[model samples]
Target chain A: MINCKALTKKYGNFVAVNELTFQVQAGEVLGFLGPNGAGKTTTMRILAGFLSPTAGKASVCGFDVETQSTEAKRKIGYLPEGAPSYPEMTSRSFLEFIADSRKISISNRQRRLEEVHELLQLGTVLDQKIDTLSKGFRRRVGLAQAILHDPEVLILDEPTDGLDPNQKHEVRRLINRMSERKIIIISTHLLEEVDAVCNRAIIISDGKILADDSPKNLESKSKFHNAVSVKLLNSMNLNIVDSAINSLPEVASTRIDENNNSLIAFPTKGKTPLEAITKLGAAEGWDFSELHVESGRLDEVFRSITGGTAR
Target chain B: MNGVSAVMRRELRSYFSTPLAYVFIVIFLVLSGWFTFNFGNFYNGGQASLAPFFNYHPWLYLFLVPALSMRLWAEERKTGTIELLLTLPLEMWESVTGKFLASWLFTSMALFLTFPIWITVNYLGDPDNGVILAAYMGSLLMAGGFLAVGSFISATTNNQVIAFILTVVVCFVFLLAGFQPMLSPLVGWVPQTIIDSIASLSFLTHFSSISKGVIDLRDIVYFALLISTFLYANVLVLNMKRGE
Candidate 1:
């Protein structure tokens, strides 16, 4: 539903987004990950038609963002970073205004407003001015405005930044619920949010895309992919277990976690360490307390791809 | 068109929802009344004309109109609502025209509230109601001219105070351009035609002609062109902000 080609945006000598290109399809939620000043928001703003790119092109639902901005914008529901709204207006009034601007029919406007109000749980504070609402409520109000018209594309910049854990979870769930019908692109620094809500993830750093793949695929790039760790019920001869586990053809290497008295084993290519560990436990009478397979760590991969440097 | 109306509705509501609309109207009424009675000598003028009342509009709007126009875009920029506004499926001209109309309509409301002055003149003696109507129209149009300039200046900055100050200074220059003192300095250094053009650009010159019940096509066209030129610049400035 969205395509960007060699999209470059510069502020004088500073390149905010440089030759960044990506595509998103319907029924896909793409998580945009990057550090501060990594061009995530800049790219999203370009896609939302709020900022013009210095070079290259971007389109939403086949409408060029720069040339056909009105058509492109009509398909988009954008929640800008910080989710700013008119402070003096009530949430209902603000949403109504947004609904009107979106060209919602007068007959359907009230129903649409009520729907978003209910969806975002904005009923209690619907009549209160936005400036008087709490941070979470204000963010919800922003979300309500973005989704009020039910546009096909949703570009949310840090949709869950200031929310509490429960609010974050609710927002993630909302995104998940809407993922099947819309092309949702969310830019956030929270790795866990990508895991929970995104079907695809792109990590950007210093105005360039560092990695783009499914969260699982990106996590699998970590060194810990397919690694297994086993904990013994009693602190017995850890070397014997380590040696026995290391002798298997599937085992690539073994390391002892002395603090936990556990043996962590790395598997050979295309190998399953669980089979070897289970067999060894059965044959050697190795009493196992905890045994599990790692899905690989996303944070490690994120840090490595982003260079683990403070922007 | 829907976008324009949506923006206009919201902007008009914003003025009323806060203390801005009421406070502005009260101050405008008081000042116009005070100026007409004290400096204008409306009661003492035996002719029973609204000349004193209409005469103060240009000077009154010089300070008051900026206060209304300063917040048109500066507040949106400062509060970051400009992002939300610009991202919507609305055109730049729609938003600019919408905001300008809202402020102009609000100013018209304030102008309308001075009806008692019109009533007072008619009650005290026979007055030219045609001239009074013409003056109201002229005052509203002059407000538009001042507001368009102020709104354009507002779009160039994010600070409301700076927007207010700059708008006042610009409007002041435009108002003073036709005055003899200001024109005298330019007469010797500049060509006669240039000096004539500068004086022709003055709000006072055009407004005075209309308020005197002389609604020339040129004066009306001047105010219309002034408003259109500044509003066009407002849209351009907003577009430049998006580029930045």
Candidate 2:
């Protein structure tokens, strides 16, 4: 497990991370969500042992980050924000050097290198300088270095930030493949990413965590949670249909989207109004299609929890 | 130890990957040869000793060593690779020492490549090869001292030119501290003990003794201490800088 107690970091008078506490266990993929400079990167850096915290303590697998730095670092793999590396080195040489620094036994070093190369699909560019590779390739190279040692804890900052859609999918799949046995923390501004990969999400703002919960539970905080949405075939009698649906006590309000010929009814409380809406549509003989209830909107929840600070 | 060698090997490979290493070695060789022949009068100095050759090393290294060490940390900082490097599972000192040793070895390699002069000196007349070897060792140690200072300065800034200039200025002070002309000005006001102590800290004071064919443990200790002192400072500064 990775643990942090009141972890904080200050740059002169600016507090980058403020008294944050959290714990992550194996098989947990934690998503760090925040606006830029919201201390997402700062928190990750402190955990990765790149920057020292001003106060508080952090540990990985029971090893204190500050006191047993090498031991703590040995159990972690970190991919920094930009995936910076030696531009002069070829992918093969750089990985070899990392393996040597890690002191992987020579007998299996080649095997591990080959595995990473194939996993990242870096065979074509293994001999090319990192500077010559594309942004996606460079990012993959950084990922390869991070997982070369198969560390227990993985801290990745914006792991899929600049990738194409396909590349992003591949990277997310890879993360999911590894999430079953390791502790992973990925920071991203992509709200859907939290829904896609993160088991739990922490929404922070101004260096303070505002909300922390599983994605589903967090999404429940959204006003759209459990709201029934239906696509109308025509805008004819839209106001009548909206008013009739809004008349029900369980249905708090209704919104009509003329652009898409759609109308949505929000629940008054923790109520499932989808069946009631379907019965009303049938009894009223309304022209509608694609009637469904939204579990929640993560973007709406993120915006609400972060108080319009979501970037 | 493995960590040190891993870093060292990567550092050495980086130097060779660019034209900088070749250009530096060529310049180092040309300048040393010019100083030894045109200025030191190696051909006309009625002596079989490589004294003329060894005498010019301190001056040659004054510029070359700083040039070699300037990019050690500054480039890493500029490129943002220092974060990846420092976060690796190794002691901070291991990285510092690895980088220092790689540059020191590079300088040593360039110095040894001047072996034709050593061969020429031996070819001309009977000369004590033992003294020459000691002089080479002294020169290598002095270069190490210069490199250590450069490494610390490099960690202080992301600008390589600034690192190079500051290292040159600091190494110059160490080089001239024991010069008789520079020291004579302080003869009246400074106490004799203070004057001697300052002179003892000079690169010239320690390196000259070793280059004179005397392998004194005191001089060796001086270079070792100087190297470690600056390298330790490098670690401390790097810890605070964090690629700033």
Candidate 3:
């Protein structure tokens, strides 16, 4: 549904987005992950047809963003960064104005307005001016305006940036519900959000795509791969336990947690830590209370890719 | 609706929704009335027509129109609303025309409120009502011209104060182009035809002619063309400033 080739954007000597290229298929929720100033917003703006690329070309729904911007814009519903809206306009009037500008037929305008109002939970604030609302409500109003026309693609920049946890969950659910029939590209730093809602995630840093893959795949590629925790019942000899675990061929490294005396183990390649643990328990008769194993989280994966902590 | 008309309606609605439009209108009406009756000494002169009232329009629009237009695109950019506006399906020209018409129409509302002066003149003497009508049209056209220039300047920056100041400076030049003290010596140095043409480009020259109850097609076309030219420039500026 969206295609960009060697897209670059610069403001004088400052490069906002550099020779970046990516695409989104129809009905895919592609989460854009990046630290601040990673050119996420600039890339989204270029794709939305708001800013022309400095050197390359972008197209949406088969329409060129620069030459055929109108058609390209028609196919995309854009919720810009910071969720900007006219402060003086009531939510209903604002939506009506956007609908009219988008050339929605008058006959269906009322229904479409109601549809988005209900979808974004903005019915109560329909008559209230946008400036009077809280940030979360205002963001919802921005969302309603973007999706009011039901465009084929939705480009949301930090859709849940300022929302509280509950509001974030609500927005996540809303985005999840709209996943079918729309090419949704969400640009955000909330890594868990991508894990919760996006099928595929793209990690960007310094105006370049670092890694793009499924959330699970990203986690699997993390450095702390297949690590596990084994807590003891506190009756075992530390030296004997350490030697027995270290003697295993699969055990690459082991460290006992000072506070809990739990053993943290890292297994080498082509080895199953669980199999090693079971065999070690049989051989050494070690008592343990907990044995848990899991892969790294999306946050760890994101931090590894972007080379900075995700805010 | 067309994109221009849609933008125009949004701008008009913005004026009404905020205090900006009302404040501008009230100030415009009071200043217009004060300039005509008090400042111009209406009763002392006992003028038969609205010459005293229409004479001060250029000076009034010099400041008033800039205030109305200062926030046009500048405020949008400052607040990041330009992203929302430009990403829409509407073409840039449509947004430009719509915003210009909105400001122009709101200005016309403020200009129209000075009608009581036209009535006051007719009440005092047998003023040429045709001249009053022509003067009203001239004032509207002149306001349109000022608004177009102001809109163009407003599109250049996100600071409304800067927009207002830049527009005032530009409009000052246009208003003074025909000043005899400024241009008379130039007439000797340059061709007389070129000097006259420069003088003719001054809004004061064209607007004063129309206010005299002579609706010259050239003057009418001049105002219309000036408005279109600036509006076109405004669109191009918006496209360039936002283009990557």
List per-prediction Cα lDDT, in the order shown: 0.92, 0.91, 0.87
| TM-score of each model, in listed order | 0.95, 0.96, 0.95
Model 3 residue runs over 4 Å out of place are A232-244, A260-263, A282-287, A309-311, B184-193
Compared with the true structure, model 1 gives a TM-score of 0.95
User: Can you give the DockQ of every candidate in the order shown?
Assistant: 0.75, 0.62, 0.81
Which is the better candidate, 2 or 3, if ranked by lDDT? 2
Q: How well does chain B match by TM-score in each candidate?
A: 0.98, 0.95, 0.94
Q: Which sections of candidate 1 miss by over 4 Å?
A: A233-264, A268-270, A278-287, A309-311
10 residues in a row with least lDDT, candidate 2 chain B = B235-244
Model 3 chain B: which ten-residue window has the lowest total lDDT?
B180-189
Best-matching candidate per lDDT: 1
How good is the docking of model 1, by CAPRI class? medium
Clash pairs, model 1 backbone: none
Model 1, A227-258: lDDT tens per residue?
Answer: 89899877567888889899999889988987
lDDT of each residue in A1-311, candidate 3, tens digit only: 78889999888888878888888898799999888998999999988987888899888999999999899999999999999999999998999999999999989888998899888888788999999999999999989988889889999999998999999999999999999989999998878898889999888888888998988889887645676678887776665676677777887888877578787677777466877787778776788888877675777777767786542
Evaluate model 2: give its TM-score.
Answer: 0.96
**What ranking emerges by TM-score with the best candidate at the front?**
2, 3, 1
Question: Per-residue lDDT tens digits of candidate 3, residues B1-244?
Answer: 7888889898898899888888988888888888988778778886687888888889999998999889999999999999999998998888988898998888888877877877777788898888889999999999999999999999999999999999998998888889987697796679989988888889998899999999999999999999999999998898887674
Q: How many residue pairs clash per model? A: 0, 0, 1
